[model samples]
Each structure stands twice: as C-alpha cells, then as structure tokens.
Target: MNAHAATDTAASSTTALPLKEQLVLVTGGARGLGAAISAAFLDAGAKVVVNYRSSSQAAEELAAAFPGQALALQADVRDAAGLKDLAAAAAEHFGRPITTLVNNALVDFSFNADARSKADELSAEELTAQFAGSVLAPVAAIQAVLPSMRQAGFGRIVNIGTNLFQHPVVPYHDYTATKAALLSLTRTFADDLGPEGINVNMVSGGLLRTTDASAATPEEVFDLIASGTPLRRVTSPAELADAVLFFASPLSRGVTGQNLIVDGGLVKG
Candidate 1:
C-alpha cells in the first residue's frame, strides 16, 4: 500500500480499540523475549493472550499478575490443527477476535560454531522441521487472524527474527536459512495484505543477554560481541520489546515489510 493509504487507515483506526481493549496474541509468551513483549503490550493497555507450548506455570504467573487483561493458552505453533484450537480458545476467552499477532516461537536454540553442516548434510525432514516453526507457523497465525482483521480494517503482525540471518557470524545453517526465508515471507505478506489494512513487519535481534535461548552461548563469545558492538553491550528483552511496540502501535502504520534490527548496531545493514 502507498504511504497515503496507510496514513488514512491509521487516522481512521485511532479510536477503534483503545490500547487496553485490543486483543493481542503473542506466541511463545511464557518466557524470554516473548514474555517481555507481552508485558510491554499489557503496559500499553492491550489485552494479551500469552500462547505457550509449555512453561504453563510461568504463563499462569504472568496472567495472574496481569489479571483481567491477560489469558494463557497452550498450543504448539508447528501444529496447524493445534493452532486452530488456539485461535478458537483465544477468541472465546477474550470475547473479541485478535487484532494483533506476534510470532515469537522458535523450535531449537543451537549456536555451535564447531558443528559442521552443509546443504548436502541436511535431510528433507530436517529442513521441513526447521521451517515449520520459523515460517509456516507465523503464516498460519496470520491466516487465522486475517478475516477478523480485514473486517475490522486494522491489524498488526510482528514476526520475530534473528541477527544470525544477517551477519552469519555463527554457521547455524538450518536456523539462519529458515529465518531468512521468514524475512522474505514477511515482506511478501505485507505486500499482499497491505491493501486489506494490515501491517506486517519483523524485529531481528542479536544474542540476547539473559534469555533461555541465549544460554547456550559461551560467556566469552558474548563478551567478544559486547566489545565489538557499537553499543558495547548485549541487548535485553525489554529493549527488543520496545522496538516491537513501535511496530504494533499507531506510530508504525506506515512501516511494513521491513526488518528492524535491534542488535545494538552489531549488524548495520
């Protein structure tokens, strides 16, 4: 969509759903960066549905603290059938269709530079499994929420990505390839759905300092990154969540199909 069209839509949607009343569904919202993003949205007055494959206790605690504003739902992103059930449950519990969707779930967090794997070494099954969590799941969630979003003439889709896809400092072949594919999907989806008044974008970050996903990274490696990074430090979940909020808010109505990197300027491109 052109800038003019997007601007018009944003102005019209200003009061459609107040920040606290909008229904937002965040995948992998039980912990880590996902949990941080959930908290940011709730703080902005959005009613959030935290989707967790596991980590039920963590999800419950978050929901309890954000009472009447957050709901915890369990569904594996890789399972299309399960995602359908998740959508139904979210709609029932929130009493409103989801207006915002965040795809933040990942399958595995392997960052071993010593491990060697080439295209030839990867099997068809391995490739499919990787894409199922990284690409297919987000696409499915977008499809599930499109009808309601289109009817309402407002939607925000934020897909979480990784910095490795951009810098390739670590040779996580399967992981990097799948995330790159997801970036492509994000752009194409934005082009296709922009006419329906939906904005789709991505937030890519480097090695986060204190998340379960980043526990595998050796301390020395993190220190090396901190030394070389322009910011001279690792990123935090809250910092990344702030970037996400900008995309989900009215401020980013004109932004879509772009990868906003929050890696402390580690990857300039």
Candidate 2:
C-alpha cells in the first residue's frame, strides 16, 4: 500500500491507542521486510522492540529515530538462550508483557540455481539450520511469551511466510519445507491458543521488490513475476506490512490459524 493509503487507515484507527502502549517484539527487524513491518508498527504508535543478530548498527539507528518508543536488541534466533534473554529484556523494558510477537526471521535465502540440492544431496545440518530459524525459533518465542499473553488475555502472533512455498517458482527445498512447517505451526498454535485470546496467523507474499533480501533477484526473474501476476507488478514490503498490521490490529480478531497470501493473485490456490 502507498503511504497515503496507510496514513488513511492509521487515521481511522487513531480513535484507540494505535497500539501505542502495546509492547511488540518483531524479529529480524533490522532491515528489508522486517524493517518495513517495524516501521508500520511504530507509525501505529506501538512500543516496538526490534531484534537483530548482526545488524546492530542498523537496528540501533532505527530505534534511535523513534527515541523512547523503540528498542534495538541483539539476539540470534538460533540461540535459544539468547532468544530467552531478549524476550526477558523486552518484558523488563516494557514494564509489561509483550502483547504482540512478529516472527519475521529467516536463514538460507540463497536462490542460486547451481547451489540447488535435492533431498539426497541435502545435509542434515542444512535442514536443521533452516528449520531452526523458520520454525523452531518462532515456537520458542511463542513459548516465552505465551504465559504473559495468557495472563493479560490478549495477544497477536504473526509468522512470516513466502508465496514461493505454494508456487515453487524455484526449488528452495529446505527453505520451502521449513516455511510450510511454520504455516502448519501457525494453525496449530492458533487452535491451541484461541481459548486464551491469542491469535496466530501467517502472511505469505511473492517476491517483494526494494528489499535487501530481493536485491539478489535477477531483473528477468522479477519481469517474469510481474508478467505472471494479475497486478502486473511485484509486491512491496510496505504492502505486505498492511496485511501484517491487519492481523495485529482489532480488525482481524477472528482471523486466526489462517495464511493470508498477498502476492497480487500470483498464487490464488
């Protein structure tokens, strides 16, 4: 969505606190799609805690821009202890439990054709690493935050997914498999947490342009994607941010355990 459209929505939602007093933790919030998501939450007046592994400078800069409203934290999702520490720090800083958790981290985004490996060629370590970031880490974060959310009786957990998992444009076997597993986790968590007033959902989108993650994508690949999509254009991180906000906001209170595809009709199934 364009800035003007987002501003309109924000204006409409201004009657409430605009997630201002709400504590939110967004993983991989240093750059790319994560950065856009963080910015969206910030614009909505949410108290954002941005988690990053190596992008410390970027994270700190983003947080500094928002002053007291943002906190840049360093935590590697692969490290369970580190994840717990970050979660604890976020809770401590907010002086209240986090009400929203956005699991937007990922590893092994390599799209090299020559690097493709089938099941037989894939190593156990590779599979484990992929799943650790895409699935296990999110699960751990959810576990860490569930008690607080349950106590407060309100929560929103959003898992970032990819449209490529459904379309298979490229054979990112390990990445696709792990993301598919995360989608399943989203539904399962939603079903398990619904009674507690917590909602779990997934947002899947096609190749998003202007993000660091998609910088490696060839121009021809994007051309092909735009031609194939009904919107005749690649999705943008800002556009996907709207879908994420919908899930986090009161607008989608009943939308749990669902995968909302924002690929501009690239994968209608």
Candidate 3:
C-alpha cells in the first residue's frame, strides 16, 4: 500500500480509475487517523477534500501542506444538507467529481476501558450519539456523494470500523454496537451499489497504538495487546491508513463488502 504502488498501477478494472486521477472526500480528515488517511491520498497524488466539523486550524494546516491538491472544508457529517454542501464545495474547488470517500469521522470518545460505560450503565443518549456518527453520518455521506458517483459510474467508499465488534475484549457497548451496524450497512451498500461500478468496504482496526482517542489507553494494555498479536507490535495510524488506500485504489476494484482488519494480526479474518 505504498504511495508509489498505488500511483504506478494502471486501471484495475473497467470502471476503476487510478488514484492520481481521483478526487477523494475524507470526513473528519483533520487530525489523528483521519489526518493520516488524508496524507496517504495526497501522497498518492489524489486531490483530497479534508472535511472537519471543528478542528479548523489543524484542517487548514493539513491543506496548507498539500497546497492546491488539498482543501479543508468544514461540515458536520451528521447533517445531510451540510454534507451535500461539502461535496459541492469540494467538486467546485477541485474542478473534478469526488470519486472516493473515507468515512473516518469519530464522535468524542476515549478508549479507556474503565471510563467506558458498561452495558447496564450505557444511556440512550450515548447510543444515539454513536449511531449518529457511525451509521447515520455514513449514510448521509453516501447520499451526498452518490449523485456524482452515479454520473461518473465510478466510486470508492471506505468506512472506518473497529475490531471490537468481533472480539469485544472490552465491550464498549455504545461504540461497538454502532460500528457493528456500520459493518452491516457496508455490506448492504456494496450489494446495492456494486452494479453501478462502486465499491463499498470497511477497514477495521484494533486499538491503535496511539491516536488522540486512544491516548487514554494504558501503556501496559498496549503492550499486552501487542504481545498477543503475531506481529508483536501495535498498529500505527500510518499502517492502518495504508490498508485504507488498498480499498480506495484500483487494487480493490473487484472487492466489496469486505472488512479488512489492520491490527497487526490481532484478529485474523
């Protein structure tokens, strides 16, 4: 999933376009893993629209690093109308339709097991917020981009998910449940959109070594998780970002509805 590997390749399928020729809209592409994803696409020569709800300064800085190739636009992914405006602004600025999307926006949450609400303690409000970010926002994002993708007959949608649904080692009730729902939507979207030449997929990761959200995780816990994995190391944001490129690139044109885990062999699927 190196930049050159994705950039040097020819078209992978009849409708699959090269990475350099694509314009990508990345939701919450301002910081943490989102920033890494944005950087990966930019490095692969793709024009990127880095959408941020708040982190305006960080978003602007990331766009500044890429000059004309990246634009930091503000939009709340939870709002469909806002997302539509985001898509329009991106296409207007880039002068090309956005053929790729990375749904990596995350609601405020920490990975500290002790801090997470237990099943019995989880509130309806917590579940609702998670659902808005995980399931509803993605639906809105897809709707926002579907028109252009339909017009071009090409699209790549990558949903950011977590492996907790499969292993549930910590059982983050609200967060894990919504992400599992997202995985289901990923498959259904793939089936519904495949005929139109669009690929919808998910990239699930275990607790990353250190993202802003996971910064609260204990150091010993990271060491323990790493030791359990065959790779004997926690996955980095850059490493997971590379896996995302696989789905967004022509490499995965024939693939859809699959959740590829990028947690250094922690959960083999």
Candidate 4:
C-alpha cells in the first residue's frame, strides 16, 4: 500500500470545518445521490453549483430550493469546454473559488446483471465508454478546478465509486473495472495534491435501493442483498450522501487518497 493512504487522516481530529466557509461543486447533482449530496452541502451552509448533463428541470428546481446559495449548471462532464465554463460560472456566481468538488455525475449504466456486458462478451468500446464517465471526466473536472483550488490554499475532492469493485458479487465487469481504475486515480491524486493542501478521496456504496439505475433491479435481488448485509438492508442514496459530506467537511481534512466503503458492512474493505 502507498504511504499516502496512511497519511490521509494524519490530521483528523474531533470536530469539523465549517461548511458555510466553503464553495462547492457537485456534478450530476440534479437528482438521486447527487441531489442528496447537494442538499447536504447547502444545509451545511456552503454555496453550491449543481452540474447536470440533461435533466434541466430537475436542476432548476434543486437550485431554486436553495435560492441564492445554489445554482444549476448544465455541463456534460466529458466535455472540457463545458467543465471550464462551469467552473467559471461557479466562481462568478459565488465570488469565490470552488473549495470542494463531488464527482457524482455517473455515465449511463444499468446495474442489472442481465443488462450488463459480461467480461467475455464485453468489448473495448464498452470499457472506453465507462472510462469516459468514470475516469476521463474526473481528470477533466480536476484540471478545470486545480488552479483555483491551489490558489485558495485549500481543497476537498470526493469521487463517487461502487462497492462492486471490492466485491463483484454480480461482476458488472465494465462498471467495476472502470471504478477500480478510478480508485487507483483517487490515491494517485491524493499523493500528488496532498502537499498542495488538496485532499482527494473516494466513497463507494453498495446497490442503492431505488435510484433510477437500480429501479430496474428485481425486488428479489434487493431482498437477497439486504439479507446478506449486517444492516439487513441495502444503502439508500440519501444515507450514502451523508457519508460523502464527511469528505468535504474539515472533519476529514487529514484523510485523502482512500476509499470509504458504505455498503451496510456487506463487504468489509
């Protein structure tokens, strides 16, 4: 293991950094876990920029709920120009650098095993498509924000991942492999950016009960997963979002380049 993982929480202590003191950016934040994370940040007193690829109405409504504290930005994470425009808009709207970023805008993928491409049948195109969302987009977003984060002398970046990478009970090959790549990038970013006062980390969750993606999942599958977990229930988007807040808060300032699995203890990392 890299020493960066051990050093991530070397500064962790009781209490938390003030959320109101931070400017935050959340990708794909219009709905689902993204919305939950955005709401949590707003409640914490931070100014937020909610980025979405489509779902304009939902984004508008979410931003409206927070009034002046939040703004809805339409940007496809895979587009460099859009990501840059988003950062610029956020800075202008909030009058400060974005101090925190949550890479939650997931590429379209069904969680159903039947719907997924098996390793034997999966193609290079499938892997590349997943990578576009899982890894490439994150790299673009980080590049878009790095100068501002460094200038501010503080930063917090949280990447959304899946517990499937740790335990591929169903082996969603393309999805899990992309996330595994992302996990590696998380640690790499933490290693490179830690000294610059930026903290990079990942929060991986198990199958969310009823997100749009998982709504296709069979009830029996949910039941089976729930029965297997110690908590006797799969995680909810809202519940997992709360855990994400910890990474953005000062409470985890010493933590970085590490993956926090929030899967009801189903698969202990």
lDDT leader: 3
For all predicted structures, in order, the TM-scores are: 0.91, 0.90, 0.94, 0.93
What are the runs in model 1 whose C-alpha is more than 4 Å off? 1-11, 14-18, 114-121
- Residues 148-192, model 1: lDDT tens digits: 676666888999998888698776777788899999999999999
Model 4 collision count: 3
Candidate 3, backbone clash total? 0
**Who wins the TM-score comparison?**
3
Candidate 3 weakest lDDT stretch, 10 residues: 6-15
State the C-alpha lDDT per candidate.
0.85, 0.85, 0.92, 0.87
Error of 2 at 177 (Å): 0.4
Superposing every Cα of model 2 onto the true structure, what RMSD results? 6.9
Which residue pairs does candidate 4 place in steric collision?
8-254, 8-255, 9-254
Q: Give the TM-score of candidate 1.
A: 0.91
Error of 2 at 225 (Å): 0.1
**On residues 151-260, what C-alpha lDDT tens digit does candidate 2 reach at each position?**
65688999999987889868678888899999999999899988677889999988888677677778888898899989999889999999999888878866799999
The lDDT ranking, best first, is: 3, 4, 1, 2
- Alpha carbon lDDT at 129, candidate 4: 95
Show model 2 residue runs off by greater than 4 Å: 1-18, 118-120
Winner by lDDT between candidate 4 and candidate 2: 4
Model 4 spans > 4 angstroms off: 1-17
- Residue-by-residue lDDT tens digits, candidate 4, 99-182: 888999888987788887766888999989999998999999998998768767788899999998878889688888889999
Relative to the true structure, candidate 3 reaches a TM of 0.94
